[model samples]
Target: MASGTSVSPNANRTRSGNTLLVWSLLVVAANLRPALTGVGPLLDRVQAELALTPAVAGLLTTLPLVAFAVVSPVVPRLAARWGPERLLGGALVVLAVGVAVRWVPAAIALFGGTVLIGAGIAVGNVLLPSLIKRDFPTRVGLLTSAYAAVMGGVAAVASGVAVPISRAVPGGWHTALGCWIVLALTAIVLWLPQLRTPRPRSEAVHTRRLPWGSALAWAVTAFMGLQSLGFYVVVTWLPQVFRDSGVTAGDAGWLLFLFQAVAVATGLVMPTMLRRARDQRAVAMLSSAVSLVGYLGLVAAPGWALLWSVVLGLGGGACLVLALAFLSLRAEDAIAAGALSAMAQSIGYLVAAAGPVAFGLLHTVSSGWQAPIMLMCVAAAGQVVVATVAGRGTVRPTRP
Candidate 1:
């Protein structure tokens, strides 16, 4: 994260100002969550065609998430070798390919393709904050807010259009998911310019302050993982959970939609507020506490789940934004930010990947929602400790 001691001659391609880069990043950001949320609404169509059972159907939804978790740990290593820009571009290609493969008629191929696609997304997901961290160092909070809003807005669009997109095609799920691949390609096209940026000197690239073996780095990564655990869990399984609690699928999806939609609004608001605080501990605690309220409400009063869904969504949404922002907040340089992002996202996502499956298994074993609901609370409580330590506001690797 130290300033560029220098740029490797081959590394610099098209040097551009931060303004243009931020704008470009925003465009990419808009594409982030759609590939994920878009396919969910069409899961039923997907299952029908494949003749997957209820459990396998659950795996279809859970597969990418599992892939996401599994792929995160390898991101930093990939970024280190390829450079963040190249890595980001490559990840988009992976996403496009993954989405494309979902349309293949074979079952093993479908699952394999899902893993490929999920892995691609996991790579891209970790890289974004690093891009923001490296490029918009001064505007971490504001830029983070923008990125968060883009994620939220796109998720809503994906959810809203999922059914419509599927209905438009006979092979609804295949085409609907395939549609996401196109978006991923577009993001790659926009990102092509970054890949052309000149690489910095060895000293800049290897500097420890921004990336590896740092306290802030670990904190940010852990926070990201914890928060994401809640968010993806809801995204993947919320509809089923609601239905089990007596809500119809339509009502349940709408509840999930509203939660994500409103979370987008809250996502924009949180970074500004969080930045103003000396440390992020209070913000993290509040975010987790609000999520707790939602979890409790949904469990105790199915009648009230609709209202509390708003609260839960808001907290989970903010958690995603905050976790990403930590890359920028903690890293002194973009490269460093990228490294930290890779680490946090990669590790954090793996942690998150367990939520849906574990929750499902818990439901099976305990014969009720109590265990899973309690698990969510415990996850939030753990955040309090991690966030407090992470939010201390001092930079690690101060030598840089």
Candidate 2:
């Protein structure tokens, strides 16, 4: 029997509506990463002003991921009740407040505001794939590639520009931190167009009871989380890691830039390559290999570590982009995409939140950098193991 998926009279209207929504989603997505990733370069300055110990500084980075991890599980349900349009918009508004709050003189307010931004970002991360799935069903790989590429490009720009912006502005760290509020405002502006009608599908999702009762689904979700855990650990602390290895700050920062910038290319290219390959295992393994080599090089040779960091960045960037692609690949349809997004990110980010804190605690306890280096090696090895599982050509056990 033919499926009930016929072109009814309202089909064209639905298509027109969703197309405009997708474009707006892309704009919002571009802003999200820059806000989260931009803070790393300025971590030291923030610490100096606040009289923060290294442990406390690490918490600044860790808290956001913890918020991300904590908020992720409820995002699909939130989207169901509130709609992605509503949640996405509200999150940005909260993000703007969070950004503004960080500029305040008080440290308590700064930490509270940072948590709010992190919680808000958690919503954006889960919502994007759902938006892509609903609007660009036929072109998910391409569009996913676009967002990943844009995300990496923004991070690289934010990293490379953080010092310059901090130097140029009188408020230094405050100004550098507030730079992202403009992007948040832009998202709210673009997203306003999506808020006109009631989100009918989301209402249905709210009413329906979906179970998180499958092993394979959990596996895929955990796979996404662990890989991200490793990636953020690197992005958050890699520059300082390089600096400690005797590399100059200027060169070390550029290597950080290279990782993020090169990922833009990988983000654009990896999905296309994955689509052509029968299984993503080879690519996943190759990415892990590069990541391992990059880290090993950094640990083994401090002076010439810049090149390896680039390689590491390239591999890490590819891994993240591919993880996004997996959300689409394993979902049965759009609704499943949203559900998978919530599942993957909720579990994934919690796992990822450990990166900075763990690194800091290990360094603090050992009173040496060797512990963190070994920990990174272990994380990179875990990445290989996770990718091997996630790259397998199969959907989650449950059907949409």
lDDT of each: 0.70, 0.73
Give a tens-digit lDDT track for model 2, residues 1-400: 0121211112344766667666677777777676667667777677788898777887777888888878877787677667677888998889888988887767887798789888888888887887677656778888888888777788788877777788898888777877788888888898897776466452245321232775555656766776677677776777777777786655665677788888787777886797898877778778877877877776677567668767877788788877887777777665667677777887778877887888878878998767877777777777777676677654433433
Question: Best-fitting candidate, measured by TM-score?
Answer: 2
Could you tell me the TM-score of candidate 2?
0.91
**What overall lDDT, based on C-alpha atoms, would model 1 receive against the true structure?**
0.70
Model 2 off-target regions past 4 Å? Answer: 1-20, 201-203, 206-213, 393-400
Cα misplacement distance, residue 335 of candidate 2 (Å): 1.5
Residue pairs with backbone atoms closer than 3 Å in model 2 (clashes):
225-348, 229-352
Clashes of 2: 2
Candidate 1's TM-score reads 0.86
TM-score of each: 0.86, 0.91
User: Local error of candidate 1 at 38, Å?
Assistant: 2.9
- Misplaced by over 4 Å in model 1 are 1-19, 44-58, 61-74, 199-216, 395-400
